[model samples]
Target: MSRYDPSAFPPFAVTVDLVVLTVREHALCALVVRRGEPPFQGYWALPGGFVRPDEGLAEAAARELAEETGLRAHTAHGQAAAGAHLEQLATYGHPQRDPRLRVVSVAHLALAPDLPTPRPGGDARSARWAPVGELLGRGGEDGVPLAFDHAAILADGVERARSKIEYSSLATAFCPAEFTVGELRRVYESVWGVVLDPRNFHRKVTGTPGFLVPSGGTTTRQGGRPAQLFRAGGATVLNPPMLRPEP
Candidate 1:
């Protein structure tokens, strides 16, 4: 083999963008921030930042998440004040995606229960959660276009959440530790943008083994009548899977 030449390859930088999602007021919302600098300055975009040299991809993702929204990362095994389920989403490396440099973004998706209002951090001018419907509007008709290729990134993350819940128990990540069947159903509705038959949804979820365990309690939080509460069980993937309706 011949000697390798460092000059032969172009220099590039890596970044971590986050699609932090939650269900608020029966709507599926994503965290967004206003850019304070040029290259889409002042445009609303997904929360992200350049990866630091000392950190790995996951570490960089977690760091950026906290810096942008004050949210601490959590897996299925732990909890925090505003804990979220974090996982690698996808990578975007279009040659001209960034004008300033050759940049590759490794995006991650985070799902959490309804969160408190976010505080702007890092290079963000302001931060808040906006409904996915409003953000993913058509041709700038329903909503304003996001900065960079963030609109595509947000769409991918939204689809991932919508589809993951159909075959896995991951939807529970958007619910509190203890939640009612009605509350869980609403989570599905918000993510999928479709209404489900309440009785059918209740039966399907309860019948799925290891999907939920009764907390042996009841609440009238939603009003009308008391509903039994349950917590997410040990099952990660559903056996037969909860199929999505034809759209």
Candidate 2:
């Protein structure tokens, strides 16, 4: 083979844009930051930044996650990670996607419980969680258009979350350490945008082997008789997958 020429290929920068999602106030929300710099100044966008020369893609994503949301990335075992459930969602490389240069973004999806309020970082003017429907203009009212191709990225991430929870116990990432079946069902409802039958949901979840390990405790947090609390079990994949309801 002939010698490889570094000058033969055009230079392009790589960035990591995060679609950090969480269920807040009965709605599925995503973390967004207002741009403080040009190219999309003062406009809302997904939290992200260019990848550094020394870090890997996952590391870059985790660093950006912490810097923007103040949340740590955890190793997902049978359950969602300690702080969040993170995974590579997709890649966007449309030539005109970035105005500054030829750039490709490795998008990551992070699912976590209602995180504490975010602190802006890098070139972010402000950061907060916004309902996915409002951000994507699917909430009946006119919504805020995101900067760059972030709107598409956010949609993809949302769909990923919606689908994964059907066959995997990924939704637990949106719940506290110990949660009631009703709380877990609500997580499914919020992410899927549908109300599930409380009785049926409890039956199915409780019957699923290894899906949950009872914590031997109960609480009246939801108001009413005390509800049993449980933690995520050792089963990552649901045996009989919970199917989405027909529209």
Candidate 3:
């Protein structure tokens, strides 16, 4: 044991940026807020800020998520948490990512059921949930870009969502407390950006034991005959996995 360290490590700041995602209008949308101040004032970016010394990474992330989306943190179970499904997405420390200082961002990923429009928080000028393609300049936004390396962080989060739902019951995080199979299928279709065969999707999902529990009810919300309603089950990691169809 040696105590020969005096400021051995260079000064750096930690921040928590969120890639809050939801499926709306049959499209995958990410929560973005317009920066109200400089560096990239007026430019839309992920909702995040420096972590306070007293807060843990998850607490800070959940706080930011609540402030930006007006949805508080609430997870009764790993799959069907009453609130948004949250997890660590990735970390970005490219040195020049943040212009202000040597900053490192521990990014968090959130998968929420359809949510209301986001409200501006912190120094944000405005906030809204925009289609991921638009935010990435793929939906004809006139080449607009996110403030920092946020774009990459968001991309990683999207990929994680697309993949996680395959082997984990995480997709239910995008569904209501009690939802129809079609609703869950739509989540897959939107996030994967591919149309899924209704029959096959239903077979795979329902066939997976401990994935969805019957809610003892049915509804005709999706049209046609009444469809049974179900809730996320206790199982988190879905056995056999729901693989995406090849392109």
Candidate 4:
């Protein structure tokens, strides 16, 4: 036999945790599930499951999302059949994360412009979208009080989204396919938690090539003139990006 290191012990199983975020009622929300079994049983936690022996991490994440929330993988107009956007968030491999066994979890992040009614499945007692700020900032001294080290995973996902918004056109992922500049600004404000100057936001968005395309349409406003609507364009990165507020 070839001389090779065979004594290295492999860690326990790996899993995929998801932090599905959405702009609901003008606030940032994340999908959470109440655990049905022991080890933080009956408490709210991130939706996740063990990775299968035959699937990639991303595939497992998509599978868990569909199994738990009934959200399909892909649909037209960025609309999932269950109304959500699914993407990889990050991987958590802390050795002591799981109490029962050594488990590494790859977290995924999702975005949806419209909130869908969540239906719990698999090992979840209930599934719903909780506001990101509440989930991330309102927990007791333990910080999310989540099952496992999920609070850290959730924080990572949220920060990933916050940073992605500055460079990628991913903010549109939080808006409808066709939207007004005002609506787009609201997405930014909601995610960043800061108000943007409408005139400057409009100028920057309109001036950026392949950022927004005019739909040649207008909608009547409650008390003002009609506002023009535009659709998301091809650009994925902002050249001179809209910066996040300094904390």
Candidate 5:
């Protein structure tokens, strides 16, 4: 047990926020909820809430993810990996980030495989998977800035996903359990916002040892010729990392 002297330091509340991304309609989109209460009522914000007395950072993150987007934490089994991919993103505790309280938010990054719909929960008035480009867009229909420091948090999450996938099997986090190379390419393209040479990208990923395992089946998700289906292999880190081009 630990003790805190009230006079030693000022108290601060803790919260958890999420940057949930997915490839939908071949675009990278983020999960956002409309704030229903004051401070930023009626504005869209990253879905989150204060940490409960008994929960850890990840627990609070998982709980908030479930409450906001109807996604749940991983169970004893690994099936939830097919549902959501979550990890710590960063923390934000700017003195002015929150107007109502002294809040320090531990942010998390989550990737969902091609999810197109979302249900709002907690105090959210509505929820949707809005295209990140538009949410960060200047003058598009979905191009409204998010409330609070969420826009900054989102930009960071996007960059993290973009960078991580280049050296990790994390791109699979944006694809289903069994996906074609073309499907996986689309995930990379959407996240990186770049069009890649199909043949070259195919060669690179396939050549990398243990990067993909053949599922002994094929599908024509891209139409025309049927493509071989594959699953994420045993390797977590890429042997020859897929590097993104300089911006």
Candidate 6:
């Protein structure tokens, strides 16, 4: 036998976990699946799976997203489809995270304007969207314990979304292709969970150079007078970023 040896340690498996977020009935919600196997079977958890050797990290994230949620990644930007966005959230490699083996999970975050519904796939038993605030708290109404360390990962994704909105045009990812300033402000309010003075919000958004571009159009009110329409501008980051209240 040869002297060379390469089996000193156990093999590590890589996984992709997704924090799928959307605004539902004025509340920020996340998609969760009920585990179908051991190690937390029947408990709520994020959608995820083992990565194929042929795929890259992001490709694995996209494949898992499509398999679980029926949403596809955008071909142009390498994010989720238009009006939706996806990006790497963080990586979790804690030993014992997966009792089955040594697993390292690279988590991803996805934002959608709104979705029709979500159905579970792969190893999930059931899937549904739940409010973020409720999932984070314990003993509160609608509060349910999540499986594994998913609660902590979900919390991190929410904070990332909130902070990203302040500087990046990412808030627009929560809106349609075209929307009014009032609508855009609503996105911020819903995610931030704090009321913003309408006048101030309008001023801040408008004054920020290249933050929004007027579509030169208006729409009749759902109840009141007509409102002007606008679309997302070219700028990605807001220099002198808009500030949110302390949490």
- For residues 87-107, write the lDDT of model 3, one tens digit per residue: 887889998998898999999
TM-score of 4: 0.89
Q: Using lDDT as the measure, name the better of candidate 1 and candidate 3.
A: 1
Instruction: Give the per-residue lDDT digits (tens) of candidate 5, residues 1-247.
Output: 7796788977789999989899988999988898889977888899999999998888888788788878676533223446567888999999889898789999988887977477888899888888888877642225555788898898899899999999999899888889999999999999999999999999999999999999999998679998899999988899778999764
Root-mean-square deviation of every model = 2.0, 2.2, 2.2, 3.1, 2.6, 2.5
In candidate 2, what are the lDDT values of residues 1-247, reduced to their tens digit?
A: 9999989998999999999899999999999988899998878899888899999888888888778666667534412346478888999999999999999999998888888788887788888888898988752113546889998999899999999999998988899899999999999999999989999999988899988899999999999999999999889899799998964
lDDT of each: 0.88, 0.87, 0.84, 0.80, 0.85, 0.84
Error of 5 at 135 (Å): 1.7
Candidate 4: stretches off by over 4 Å: 1-11, 75-85, 140-144, 221-224
Candidate 6 lDDT, tens digit per residue, 131-228?
Answer: 88888876122455787678889999999999999889989888888788888888898899988899999999988999999999887743488888
Clashes of each: 0, 0, 0, 1, 0, 0
Ten-residue stretch with the least lDDT total in model 1: 74-83
Off by over 4 Å in 3: 1-8, 74-81, 137-142
The better candidate by lDDT, 4 or 5, is: 5
What's model 2's lDDT at 174? 92
| TM-scores, all models, native as reference | 0.94, 0.94, 0.92, 0.89, 0.92, 0.92
Clashing pairs in 2: none
TM-score: the better of candidates 2 and 4: 2
Displacement of residue 96 (Cα, Å) in model 4 is 1.0
Model 4 agreement with the true structure over 143-232: per-residue lDDT tens digits: 547788877888888888899889878888887767889888988888888888899999999999999999998877424788898888
| Residue pair clashes in candidate 1 | none
Using TM-score as the yardstick, the better of models 1 and 5 is 1
Please estimate how well model 5 matches the true structure, expressed as its whole-model Cα lDDT: 0.85
